[model samples]
Target: MTTTPMPVLEELSAAEALRLMAGVPVGRVVFTEGALPAIRPVHFVLDDGGIVFRIVGAQRLADGLHNTVVAFQTDEYQADRGDGWTVTATGHATRITDQDEIARLARQLPLPWSDRGHMFRIEPELVTGRRLTR
Candidate 1:
């Protein structure tokens, strides 16, 4: 008997992925804790090649929401060809401490979610993506 191995996702073009992610309004934010990984869906935006969002007292935020590298991904799927694409942005997150900068960023990117969420930013070092092109 022969066995087949699962194929890993091949990387997509950064530009294409960014375009898709920019158009989307939400994504999954992934992080690590001890030997386990945790992920949560979040509303986000892309600005100046970075990801930004607000979270309201979530455990993920309480655990560690600053200066840590995390992965952010967004994707969409259709019935045909199982057509879909995903973009992952790996970056460091930090609380926006500067009032002026916060105000500026706020104007460009408003927080559409609840008011309880605090402003956080992720500056991505490497952004890659993949899509099912049939």
Candidate 2:
């Protein structure tokens, strides 16, 4: 039997990574709470230099009580061929308390997968991405 060739991996530029992230509807958010790490899958919309999302309740990370530095990751990968890209954005997360801004973002972003009452925004200081090519 013939074997498939090894896949090559490449790093994506910050702009390209952001573009890829905007095209997808879902991703995972990682943060630290106390001495442990936590991760949550979330839906987001890109806005200027920040990414915005909505949540239902106090998730500790979103409640403005835990660590502010977090990483938001989005990717699309094919298991069979191992071809696709993954983008991770590191930044500070803060809940949007302004009613007007919330209204504006609500109109721009797609409806969240879950029932969420609060909106949050994260301004990424660094963004990195990687892709596998077959």
Candidate 3:
């Protein structure tokens, strides 16, 4: 069988990054537990110039809620040539517990791909990304 060629890889600008983020609904949240790092896929929304999502029964994730400094990323990948685009945003996350805040954000974010949702908010301090086109 013949294989397809890979697309060119390019760096995405800040504007492009934000635009790309606006289109996607899921991303990975990276955090550290003791010495090891963990990443989990989460459905999120871009609101108030930040990221917000709900978590159900994530104990480890609940621990990370202590601080806002975290790494959130979204990307696309292909196995054939291992080509894709990934955008990583380094920022702090805040657990929104206030009833008013939750209600407001809830109105803005419908629901994630999961049945039970735990809401969390993240504000990016630095954003960097690369795109690989085939």
Candidate 4:
């Protein structure tokens, strides 16, 4: 007879969570729209202790929602091995309009997938993550 080892579920430290987040370029940004919870997938970069990404100026996301409280989440999972991790960061998001900062971020962001050109930043106030492994 044989028994499979139990999988371990672990909570990653905040630093580790942030480090993991830095490596991921895609995530969901959660927010409230018309009093309803909403989420949008976006490409992002970790910079200056914040998450920065761009959207076209005409997008709904580019509407007057600066300084809104929001959440950003990223995760990876393997169904076959049941091994994966998830990271989430919550904070207030603000539009970054400084030309100099935008230029700096332009160098860091992946090639734009959309046509609009508004940039925003989120300074995470809380970060948490979990990992599962055998």
Candidate number of the best lDDT: 4
Candidate 3 residue-wise lDDT, 1-134, digit = tens: 87877578799986687678777878888877666787778888888788887766567667656474888899877877668788888888788778887787777665544335567888988888898877
What is the descending TM-score order?
A: 2, 4, 3, 1
Q: How many Å off is the CA of 119 in candidate 2?
A: 1.5
CA lDDT of each prediction against the hidden true structure: 0.76, 0.81, 0.77, 0.84
TM-score of 3: 0.80
Model 4 lowest lDDT segment of ten: 56-65
True-structure lDDT of candidate 4? 0.84
**What pairs collide in candidate 4?**
56-116
User: Model 2, range 4-121, lDDT digits (tens) per residue?
Assistant: 8888999999999999999999888787766688777777888888988776556654565223888999999888776999999998888887888888888876655423666778
| TM-scores, each model vs. reference | 0.79, 0.88, 0.80, 0.87
Query: By TM-score, is 1 or 2 better?
Result: 2
How much lDDT does candidate 2 score? Answer: 0.81
lDDT of 3: 0.77
